[model samples]
Each structure stands twice: as structure tokens, then as C-alpha cells.
Target: MPILSYLVGKTRKLGLGATRSTTYYEPAHIAREFATLDHLSKGRAAWNIVTSMNDSEGRLFGKDKHLEHDLRYDRADEFVEVALKLWNSWDKDALKLDRESGVLADPGLIRSVQHQGEWFKVEGPLNIPRTPQGRPVLIQAGSSGRGRRFGARWAEAIFTIHPHLVAMRAFRDDVRTQVEQQGRDADSCKVLTAVMPFIGGSEAEARAKRDRHNALARPELGLVTLASQLNVDLSPFALSATLAEVAESPLIHAAAAEKLLMQGPETTLEQLGRIFASSVRVPQLVGTGAQVADQLAELFEQGGCDGFVISPAYLPGSFTEFVESVIPHLQRKGLFRTAYEGSTLREHLGLADLPG
Candidate 1:
């Protein structure tokens, strides 16, 4: 009955530094650790690789100063490259059983991969053998210049938090171009964006709910947040003043929308600032089940997004309602499956068979 595997993201620290940080985990250590998780979870492991931009993260790594943006991703590229070699080190049939004469696994079947790369130099095979599934599914979360390149090259799935359709389409197109340029199949990756639901049975009810949600957000917090994003202070501006009078921005976007704001339909500076303060211009889905389903289908069909990350505004009950009520409607309409058929997440997403 377990369904809808989200990105269990971990910070990918490059270099063979001791796998420290409750905040981050190295791929080499994670590859071995996550294989065990995959074994236990019936092969549902999605590694959402994130190289953080936060300076606090740098301090955790024992660096007094933060890394340059270029260096962060440069290391990410090498980190993933080594991670793949580590994953593939154990072939699909690496574990061969020989039941007679006290034999266990065939030694010939197990081979060590001596991988030496720019950022990592792993000596041999991963501790665990090839899983029932090939490997943990790789999810990439970044929308910056280097981030997109990383996602296009390696991500089987993309976690995006886009503000609107026009921006969403541009993201898809840009990544698709990278796919074409890299000589890889464009369809191999799926882009999932974040959309929060605030169901209402009627339009008036929905609008009222949105107003209530907005009421919970203070304009000062909004102003400060917006200022931080734009790298300026908005304290000088009145809360009632038009945002354009205070600052200029084209749109709003997030990485969990997973990329910084991408160019799309124009946004008023006020509306754009609101997006930063409270996520979801209309990320709040206040509608009936049919209405919500219709919106989702429309987004998938017209917006060109493969699916949504779908965060719950509240905790357990929120996701619980979605899983129990909304998912069945989706299944009945043939938008989602009633059950999982594959062991690993990759197999679940139909990527195990993809040519590398």
C-alpha cells in the first residue's frame, strides 16, 4: 500500500572526506548505506542529490568560507560520475548462487571496479552486491546554470518548484535541449514540480481560503524575504506601495520548483514578492476532487510537467487525505496506478531498462 516516493534528498559533499554532517552525506558512503535501505524498502530508494548553496553547509565541511558557485557543481559532476561507477561496479548478475559442495556466491561473478576520477578515486566494488533492482533512482535538485547541466546529464527525475506554466515549459525546453545536445534520450528524465492543494467545493470558497492563507503571512516578513532574494532591503518601501516602485523582478521560482525563477509570463513586482513570501500564487488547490484532478491533469497535459512533488500544507492528515481520497480518483481515471508493480524505484519509474 506504500506509494508516491518523494525525493529523500541528501547533500552531496565532494572529495573523500570522512562522511560527516547530519546535514550531508557523501555518495561513496551513501551508495553503500542506501543499498541496504533499498534491500529493506523493497527497492524503493530515490537519491535526490543536492549540492547546497548555503554557507552554513560550508562551515560543516570545515571550510571557514563558502565555495564558489562554479566549484560546487564542478565537484558535483565528479561526485555523481564516481557514484555511478560505484553503483555499476556490481553488475546485474553479480551474485551467482552455486548450491552444491558448500559453495555460495561465484567469485568470478563478483568483480571489483577500480574507478579513478577527477574528484574521487574509489578502489573497488561497493560492499553490497547488485540489488534486486539495478540501483537507487537518481533525482537531481537544482535550477541554476550548473544545476541544470547536472540534472540533464544524470538525473532520472527532476524536482522543480516552478511558479507558472510559461516558466515550467521553458525549464522543460532548456533541459530537453541539453538532453539533445548530450546525445542522450530526452524522455529518460521526468520533471516533477511542487503544487500545494487547498481543496474547496466552490470558487468562492476557494478564493476565501486563499485569502485566509494570505492573511496568515505578514507583509513585513514578505518584504524582508523578498528583499533577501533580490539582494536588497525593502524596509524603505511602504507595505501598500506598488512593488515595482520598490524593486523590479520578472517572476518567482524555487529549486524545489528546483530552479531559481525562470523567465515566463510577466509578473507584477507585488505578485512576484508574494510568491517568495508564501509559496503558491495558486499553488493552493482549493477545489472539489474533480476540480483538483482536472487541474492536475491539465498541468500534466498542458503544462508539460510529468507530475508534481505535492507537499502537504499540514502534516499526516494532509498527505493522508491525498493518498486515501485523491489517489483513488486519479487511479479510476487512469492517471495513477492502484498499486506498485516494480521492486526498485527505478523499475517503478520505468528507468532500469534505460540505456546508459
Candidate 2:
């Protein structure tokens, strides 16, 4: 969050987002922090809401175990509710800088958010006035059924992961349906799938580069990451055994395990570990600049996603390559913006106004 806040001063038009877990922090703290960020960034701030995944994280929070999935979502729903109330506590016109009368603001314009919910109780007319974008943009990245429903209710943008076009389209369609079910315009929430692009002068070069990167992955590290994400112990499983063999493990998170199994039930633990370690399961897009752009265009045009969350394999280099090579192609094709069209992140995303 500090880094993102710092970047707000260094860059313009880049939305500064920070992930805050609903399972741990106080709703008022999250509200005040993001509200301050929005004001500091001139409304270019976003909060990536998460109901943290790791059980170890629970230990840090003085819990014996992580909250059950659906229960966690329930808490998150209330967390967001409390935050919204706090953010709306002060009206947009609450501040009246009338120098002549020596009045700084109108007390009548501000009201306490007397919220007492299932998970949080906050009395707030937040210390800060109403933010520039009304409230910081809300973002979420939960692919489970409950997670999707929670997101549909609040997320302005959703980050997702799907290995194929079919899966991507299905996820988007399902989320949009749920959004409409929540009485929101389907377009109100943007779905962005994760994609790791390996761009080169040609497709073959890109493929080779990707293969080389994959080869360098340490399977053991991936097994640990996969274990953490699934909330199961992978150490007991033989690396040579196929994921299907352990799909029925009682300790595993069924939904997350099932998603991994989708890669191929026949895929060995070693291979799966390598894949997860390398890309964390985000789909790879390997090709020349134009070819990669073509793939992204296809996904967007085919109802797969509203956009992508580019997961670069390496640091500044990978990001630099995408900006120098792929972005130009997207811009030339009229698929991406060449310049800033709006000052605030909400305007840039073409998001609808917050519901009263």
C-alpha cells in the first residue's frame, strides 16, 4: 500500500490498487486508508478486496484455522457493507470552505455510519471528507461460487484465472448473469483474466523462451505453493503420481483442486508443480507482438473477458517488452488506448456511478 501510494505521485493515469483482506483488518481502517488513497491519487485508487486464502495467515491473526470458504465470503460481504456506509458517511458537498464566515464545513452534511453488522461494528463519518471518485473503485478476485456472488454485489472489476477460452467465456458469462441477478448492469463489472505473455520477434522464439523459462522452474517450490493454495499437504503425494490419484484427498479444497485437475487429471504432480511454480496457473500467451495481440483480441471479441491482467514472467524486462512490443500492436489495431482519456480510474474504466 505504501508503494502504491508512493507511485501515485510518480505516475498519472495508473490506477493504484492495494489488496486488503476482509478477514483480518477492521472495516474502518480499510475505509480510511483507501479513502485517503483516493484523495491522494485524485480518485485513481482501487481496493482489491480479498478474503485471505492461507491457513498460515490465520495463525498471524491469532486463529487456529482459516474461516470456511462460504463463511469467509459472508464476513467479506458485511465488511464491504460497513466500508460503504463509512465512505458514504460524509456527503460530497460536506466540505464548505467559506472563509468570510470562518466556517470550514457544514456539520449537518455529515452523518455517522451507525453500522452494526454480522462481522463489523463501525461508528464513522470517516475522519476524511467524501473522496473524489465518491469512493475508491472496488476490485475483487474470487472465482468460487460464493466468491463470484459476493463480487457481483460489489466489485467494479474482477480478476480471474482460466486456462482456456471456453472456461474463460463460461466464467465471464456466469458472473455477468449473477450481476444482472443482483440488479446491476452486466457491464458494470469488468472481468479481466490473467495472461502471461512471452513476446519475441517470432512465434518460435517466443515458444523457446517460454520453454526455457519453464525448464528453470523448481517443482518442489511449486508443490509448496500449490499445497498452500489448496490448503492440503502435497508432501505426502509422490511426485510421479497423477493429480487424479490425489483428487479425492480429504484434506484438499475440492473446488481449487478440481480447477487444478482441469489442466489434466493425468498430469503428474511433478508437472503440475512445475506449471504452478512457473505461472501460478495463469494462462500463457506466447508469440510475436502482433500474434499475441491477435490472441488477446480473439479472447475479448469471443466473450472470454473484458480485458487481461498481464502476468509478466520477469520484472521490468517482461513488462518493458510488453509495453514496447505488444501495446503498440493493440493500439494500432484500435483495441487499446494510446493516451489517457480520463483523470480518474473510474472514468478510465467507464464504470457506472455508485448506487445510492
Candidate 3:
């Protein structure tokens, strides 16, 4: 959050997002922190809501065990409810900086939140005034059933990982239906698919760069990560054994296992592990700038996603290359903005203004 706050000072148009776990953090604290960030950034702040995964994260927060998956989402739903109440506590005209009258604010305009929910109880109005954007943009990244439900209710933008176009379109369509069921506009929530691009001057050069990057992946490390994500023990299986062989593991997450099997029942556990470690299963685009742009355009036009979340392979260089190379192609195709269209993040995303 501090890093994002610092970035707010350094940049003018970029949306500064920071993740906060609903399972671990207090609702009031999150409300105050993000409110401050929104104020500092002139409404460019965004909050990526997360219910932290893994038992290890629970241990760090002084819990004996992590809450069950669905239970975590339940808690998160209430947590966000409380945060929204606090954010909306103050009226738009609450603050009145009249020097001559000496009235800093209108006392009656600021109402107490007085929220008491299943996971949290926050009382009274927030100390800070109403934020410029009303609240920071809500972003979520869960793809499971419960996760999708929670996101449909709260998230203005959803970050997802689906390596194939069909899966991406299915997920987006499902979410849009759910959002409409909740009585919200289907277009209100934007779905963004994750992609890691290996851009070069030519397609062959890009493929070679990607292969070199993939060669450096350690299969053992990949196994460990894959085990964690699947919540199953990989130690019992031989590296050469195919995922189809272990599909019957009672401990394995069914959806995750099924997705892995989709790659190929004959694909070795080691190969799957290596793929996970290399890109965490995010789709990899290996091509020149124009070629990469074409892939993204196809996905966008096919109802697969509203946009993309570019997951870079490396740090500064990966992002720098995309900005310098890929962005120009996207701009030429009228798929990306050539310049800032608005100052606030909401405006940038074309989100409707919150009712005052």
C-alpha cells in the first residue's frame, strides 16, 4: 500500500491497486487505508479483494487453520459490506471548507455506518471525508463457483486465468449472467484474462526467448507449487506419472485436477509441474508486437474478455518491452487508448459515477 501511495505521487494517470485480504484484515482499517489512498491519488486507487489461500497464510495470522473455502467467501462477503457502508457514510457535501464561516464540515451530513454483520461490526462514520470516486475500484481474482458469486456481487473488475478462449468466454458469460441476476448491469463488471507475452522483433526470436525462459524452470519447484494450488500431495506420485493416473486422489481439488488433465491425459506430472512453474498456467503469447496484438484482439472481439492483465515474464525489461513494442500495435488497431481520457480511474475504465 505504501508503495502504491508512493506511486500515486510519482504518476498521474495510472490506477494504483493494492491487495488486502478480507480474512485477515479489519474492515475499518481497510476502509481508512484505502480511503486515504483514494484521496492521495485523486481517485486513481483500486482495491484487489482477496480471501488469502493456503493454510500457511492462516498460520501467519495466528489461526490454527484456514477457514473452509466457501466459509472464507462468506466472511469476505460481509467484510466488503462493512467496508462499503463505511465508505458511503459521509455525504458528498459533508465537507465545507469555508474559511470565513469557520465550518470545516456539515455535521448532519455525515451519518454513522452502524453496520453489524456476520464477520464484522463497524460503527459510525469514517474519520475521512467522502472520497473523490466515492470508493476505490473493487477488483477480484477468484474463479471458483463461490468466488465467482462473491465477485459478481462486489467486483467492478475481475482478473482471471484461462489458457483457452472457450474457457475464458464461458467464465465471462457465466459471470455476466450472475451479475444480471444480482440486478446489476452486465457491462458494469469487466473481465480481464491474464497473459504473459514474450515479445521480440520476430516470431522465431520470441519463441526462442520463451524456450530459453522455460528451460530455466525447475521441475521440483513446479511440483511444489502445483501441489500447493491443487491442495494435494505430489510426493507420492512419480515425476514421470501422468496427471490422469492421480486424478482419483481424494485430496485433490476436482476443478484444478480436471483443468490439468485437459492439457493431455498423457502429459507427465513433471511436465505439468514445469508448465505451472514457468507461467503458473497463464497463457503465453510468443510473437512480434503485431502478432501479439492480433491474438489479444481476437480474444476481445470473441467475447472472451473485456481486456487483459499482462503478466510479465521478468521485471522492468518485460514491462518496458510491452509498452514500447506491443502497445503501439494495439493503439494502431484501435484496441488501446493513445492517451489518458480522464483523470480518475473510474473514468479511465468507463465506469459510471457513483450516486452522490
Across 1-356, the per-residue lDDT of candidate 3 in tens digits comes to 98998898799899999999999999889999999999999999999999988777789889988888899999999999888888998999999999999999999998877877777777868999999999999999988899999999999999999988999999999999999999999989999899999999999999999999999998888988877765567888888988788786675668667866877989998898899889989999989988998999999999999989999998879999998988998899998999998999999998999997
Candidate 2's TM-score: 0.96
User: For every model shown, what is its TM-score relative to the native structure?
Assistant: 0.78, 0.96, 0.95
TM-score of 1: 0.78
Would you give me the overall lDDT of model 1?
0.63
RMSD over all Cα atoms, model 1: 6.8
Candidate 3 — number of clashing residue pairs?
0
Off by over 4 Å in 2: 248-263
Tens-digit lDDT string for candidate 1 (1-356): 12222222231211011121212456678677656656555566666777665555678678775666667787778777766667777766656666665665656666677767666677767778776455667787677778899789988888787767787788888887897788878878888878887655575775676677766765566656545543344565455555433333223222212222332234344555566566544366767666777778877888558878787766656677666656777888898976666545665576646332
**Residue 218 displacement in candidate 2 (angstroms):** 1.7
Candidate 3 regions exceeding 4 Å error are 249-265
The true-versus-predicted C-alpha distance at residue 56 of model 2, in Å, is 0.3
- Model 1 poorest ten-residue lDDT run: 11-20
Per-model clash counts, in order, read 10, 0, 0
Cα RMSD (angstroms) for every candidate in the order listed: 6.8, 1.6, 1.7
lDDT: worst 10-residue window of model 3: 248-257
